[model samples]
Target: MLSLFPQILFLAPLALTLLRVVLAIYLAYIAWYLLSRHAEIEHAELPIIGHARHGILWLSAISISAIAALLFIGAWTQVVAIFATVISLKQLVFYKRLKEILPFPPSTCILLLCISLTLIVSGAGGFAFDLPL
Candidate 1:
């Protein structure tokens, strides 16, 4: 295929950086939502973490927050992306029930999964702590 905008090809890194940031923000939103809902419910079953206790829910929320921070800063991006991928995959596989709990559409879960996989394959991109060796 012929190049439509070859001059802007160098900006690929920035695009990946944007993707990473966006994914980080979404993850943070999920964490916040989880925590807010966790307050209302004493116990609720969660995908990949069934029969959730109060402490488990809090731990999950904290873990998700940590992942979001790590992703936003682009530290250990591939590893973080791997964890994100797993979480999203779990959500996607259990989309029917997850939607009711998370209030996010299945499409959003699919998008999150795709973005996480992309980050895993592409690394942290520009302005990130991780540099390809």
Candidate 2:
């Protein structure tokens, strides 16, 4: 499989971009759905934001969306990727309903973080708006 790395390097930028966009959209969608539809459901089990006000969820969603946008366009690729990876892990740790994300191993956040780390190491690839470092 290592031999295939160079073969698909050309597709890396696009793949990374799509990954960021999807993660962002999913985060925003989950936050929106939970906040708007289940505001009173009381997810008191969240490790990070359980004690915080509900507004924090909105802020997290908005921030994640913005970071996703940045990651999509390859702007500040390394920095944004790092930020995104950290946030993604945090979300995975705190967000309930793990089974809803994926029925199998390698949850969405894990896959996304791997992709983000690849972008960080390899840069944005040839098709990116911001060239790899």
Tens digits of per-residue lDDT for model 2 on 26-52?
Answer: 545545655563344344444444544
RMSD of 1: 2.0
CA deviation > 4 Å runs, candidate 2: 1-42, 92-106
TM-score of model 2 (CA atoms): 0.63
| Angstrom error at residue 121, model 2 | 0.8
Give the CA lDDT, 0 to 100, for residue 125 in model 2.
Answer: 47
TM-score of each: 0.88, 0.63
Which candidate number has the best TM-score? 1
Ten contiguous residues minimizing lDDT sum, candidate 2: 97-106
Report, for all candidates in order, the number of backbone clashes. Answer: 0, 0
**Pairs clashing within candidate 2:** none
